[model samples]
Target: MKTGDQTPLICYQEMTRASWRQFRPTTDGHVAAVSVDRRSQLALMDRRPSPSEIYYRPPAGVYWVDVSVHHAMLHLELPTAEGVFAFRAAIDVAWRISDPVRAVKDGVKLCEPIYRPFLERKLRDMSQEFEVGSFADAERHINTYFADRAVDLPSGVAMVRCIVKLAPEDSARNHIQQRTFDRHKAERRNAEHKAHLHGAELQHDWNTTAHGLAMQSLAHGQETAAVEQRHREELEQQRIAHYTSALQTGGIGVLALQLASSPADVSEVVQIMLHQKQLDLESARDVLNTLMEQRLITRRDVQDVMAPISKVIADRLNPTASLAHREPLPELAAPPVGPVGQVEESEGLDEDESDHD
Candidate 1:
């Protein structure tokens, strides 16, 4: 068999069993050939190819040849009035024609994912719309409706538009009832959401009140404890001051009494007493009491007698006396007689008088 040029020869025709068989090689030496049985050949020759197929062929300048197989339109009859309504709804929902060609292609793509499932669910939910009767009339109705729909369908898709023709025999009441049910369901969902929010708000308010009360109680207890503690500290300080004043007064009185009974060398006595008694006023008082009891002196005797002696001794021992005794003493001498001339004069006068006589 002789092979054609590397450039591929593309052809378009309606899909069918015999149409596909035509692409197979025959007994002749042609590498690629297309043949159809008499009936299919006539059908292919009679029909024109679609615009997409015409454009898809290569060798940009080459003209195109048309071919076709069975090109009958397929129709689907919904089983119920609800089905019909849902179909109409779906058609309405898919109304956008953005990029008409692409939208139509996309709408076909969207059929299984969006429209088919939506239609099935709607039919299940509103079963009353399905009327058990001749599907032929329903099919006819759907075909007419879809044809009209396809007129507005985005271009490029090879779909026949359809419509939903309600049977004159079916009741309109079912559709009305389903619409009411849908509305009620929506309202119930909203009510449930609002109730949930109300419950949450109430719980939040309760928690806030509880926390606030707990904090207030804690603060009140702490404040009360602080005030009581302050009062206790003030009372303790007052007690300490009273005891300290009494101790100092008693110490001064005891110091005076001990000094009165002290010995004449009382400074040394007091110093010795301080050392032996650990410099305590109470110990000095004890020493004075012991001396008074041993000597049998009355309190007056201790005051008047011992006190004077102590004073005299203190004055004698004063540091100023030694400084006063520092002046020098005069040397001793005898009394003198009268001069000898005075004695001779008296003797001579007596002799002269005798001679004159």
Candidate 2:
């Protein structure tokens, strides 16, 4: 019968016939047919007025069921260090079906090309450890399984959610130990470098101070030696002046004694000698006596030298007696008388003769 046109009575008869055909030993088994009125009622109910109600009704086309078939559900569990895991899978199969029925049915082969490979690949790749600690990784694995199988699963299928716990004390201890060791090493190296620099500065200051003191000592020694040499030169000059003055006084005394012993007046002799020699009395006598004893004044002799010496002294002492020693003038003769005087004298002689007689 056609879909939507069969009575309920005919639908019941078709179901019974299909069941018997599946149980029979061979294809040639006897087949019984149901009446037409019963099939028509089942077809009319499947074609309900509301589309929503139609899906709830049984199908009106030819119906069949295999009696020898059985469905099974598989359950699995996995254990790890983290936790326990569980999952389930449902599988269905058909038994003793004809070639035409098997070929026309959907999802008929249990271990078909799509399902067999998909199951094997997912089991091999399952993670032993999940560090991310979330069900997101498991969801991705299930999605990959469905994609390879060419299956469109309903929502909420193949879902996994898990919780993870960790220990906090071990992580904190490791971090503190490393930081403490690094800080001590840096401080020790810095201290050694500072000490070395301070020692070099002290040595430089000592050398500069010693050089300044040495220069000051050399300058003071030169000034002291110059002052002592000047004092010795002034003392030597005073000693030479004293010796020259004593020799001049002794020579003047000796010449005065020699002039006093001469026979001529000492003053006149000394004055004439001083005029000729152009020197003082003591110096002149010393020069003359020395010259005479040496035979150097031979042109003038000294015989009766006392006479000329006394005359020169009298001229100096009495100047008038020398002027009176000059020559006198002669007396004049009387004049004589003549004849008139002679006649008168003869007459006078006669008269004198008469008076006497």
Candidate 3:
């Protein structure tokens, strides 16, 4: 049928038996109302209503009423969690008149008036079971409640289906979001503080370890230096002992010749000669004569060493005779060394040289 020509979901009227003649003819999608006298003898209609009869309504008659399937969408704010917050809900309610004659007797006309109050009461009762944050759970419970069991309605009406969708109200949703944000912020701050403390502890440990290593290195260095100094002192003592033994065996004259050969020990030998009280002028002259004959020392070295001692010697030995004006010291001959057999061998070498010459 055309939408404009379709029947309303509910209709009711009253008329005399003769005035009922003006009622429109019932179509395939419509149901015609019966007179009060006709209803008492009529059999009950047992067949289920058709899907296409959503807007169908029966024709008018004496004490007439008609009804069809009715669909409605409803909105409500349902309190939850003991009224701490509320959820906004949309309800799609489908209902129909199960008994037309009984519906008229019960004074039912529009389907909304009958279904709205019943749906609100059911939803409010169910909403109390959950919190605002549990909107999804609340919606599921509501859908399941209507789906699992058929609920009875007033005025001979039957329930088809009730679909419920729930969400938090604006204020309740904002409050929940703010709390979540605050909780996360606090957690992040705590984590940062813990990380900072951990980093500081690690740095402190590193510094402590570094300081320990530095102390160990310094102690090792000091120990090594002390060992090196002791080794040097031991070497110097061994060297002095060797020089003293050479002096005891070879005499001052031989030691002086040995010292003159190594120019580096010149200052040391001079110091020894100046300090030796047993060294007489004869021993000193022998040492100098051997040094000159061997060509070991320069004239400059001789002058530098003897210039100061000359005055001391001239003062002790002839005060009237100036040392520079005096005659040179007589050359002292070296005594023969080794056994008589070695001396004879040396005399044989001299004879061979004289014959060759």
Candidate 4:
């Protein structure tokens, strides 16, 4: 390959019509030379010449005198950055055919046997001149080789163009390697994606569990407070029950002792006063008098409590007594004697003053 830009390929006619028909008079003239070369070239052409179109096929060649020129596909072991590769190059060359009449016998192809070696050196120089991966450089170099060196061919032939390519196996191997690398990369990305989703799911579950635990702790605190409140209420009921029981069993004496400090016992004292589910007149009087002595109640409270009982007693003693409108009574002179207060009839009464004379 060359280091410069590739100019257009130069083609020349094998033999122009003017040169073919010139010098008709001469037997051993240009006609003779043109006829020999033309015979071989025509045979290689394998088609009638058309006025408007000409096609050049593989193995382009030239034959003049004893020279036989040819060009064919050339396989090369090319060193590249990727490693040594089988580079197949199709090259056009000017070649020759046997012509014993002229007694000129030299090269088999148009060039000498050293030509392939020359080309190999050129390829090596090209390998150093351009990077291995540069297809554009290699293409331009090959095209330039054909363009510039076509003038070097035998006098009858021209090279149209030339090109190079990798061998079939190397191209396939490169494609497969690329696809495999892409697949591996995609699989690794998929694995990472799944791992990311799994991590997110685990974190979500942990958060949900933590939230549930916090809610349960709050609910437990609420339940504990409710249980404490119920316990306090039960204790308060028990204390009231104790006070009521003491008052019912021991009458006014127990009530007086319980009411000694009335400020703290105000509610209990009110309950005791209002508790009349079971009572007798004697028990009522005892309770009232004790409450008065304790100063938990006034004398008026005791009188009010005893009023009904005193009226009942008076009615039994004297049915004619109108106690509803009776005056306020003084306090008892003393505690009741016997069953109740009473007076007996005297023994001497004068018998109605001796029968009234």
Best by lDDT: 3
What's the C-alpha lDDT at position 114 in model 3?
A: 76
What's the ranking of the predictions by TM-score, best on top? 3, 4, 1, 2
Cα lDDT of model 4 by residue, 1-357, tens digit: 221112211222344543333322223322212222423432322233454322323222322332223444556655544454434445444322323222222222333343456556666556545434454466576666656444322333333334555332366358656867999999999999999999999999999999999999999999999999999889777656766786567455555555564446654454444334223545755665555445465433344544566665554344224323322233322335232221111101123333564
C-alpha RMSD for every candidate: 27.3, 36.9, 16.0, 17.0
For candidate 1, the 10 contiguous residues with the lowest summed lDDT are: 61-70
Q: lDDT order of candidates, best first?
A: 3, 4, 1, 2
lDDT of 1 by residue, 1-357 (tens): 112112222233344433333333233321222223334331112233344434443111211121111122122233454344322222322222223223322323322233444434543344343443433354454445445443322332222223333332234346555656988998999899899999999999999999999999999999999999999789657644543453446453444344445434235433443333233433434555555446443444445544554444343334234224322222112111121232334446556766899
Q: What is the lDDT of residue 125 in candidate 4?
A: 59
Per-model TM values vs. the true structure: 0.25, 0.20, 0.46, 0.30
Residue pairs in candidate 4 whose N, alpha carbon or C atoms collide under 3 angstroms: 67-96, 67-97, 68-95, 68-96, 68-97, 69-94, 69-95, 69-96, 70-95
lDDT of each: 0.39, 0.35, 0.63, 0.46
Better of 1 and 3 by TM-score: 3
- Give the per-residue lDDT of model 2 (tens digit) for 245-303: 42345443434344344324344433433343233322533554554456454323332
Q: What are the runs in model 1 whose C-alpha is more than 4 Å off?
A: 1-77, 80-193, 241-357
Better of 3 and 4 by lDDT: 3
lDDT of 1: 0.39
Off by over 4 Å in 4: 1-71, 82-109, 112-119, 125-160, 168-357
Higher-scoring candidate on TM-score, 1 or 4: 4
Worst 10 residues of 3 by lDDT: 331-340
Q: How far out, in Å, is residue 222 in model 2?
A: 2.2
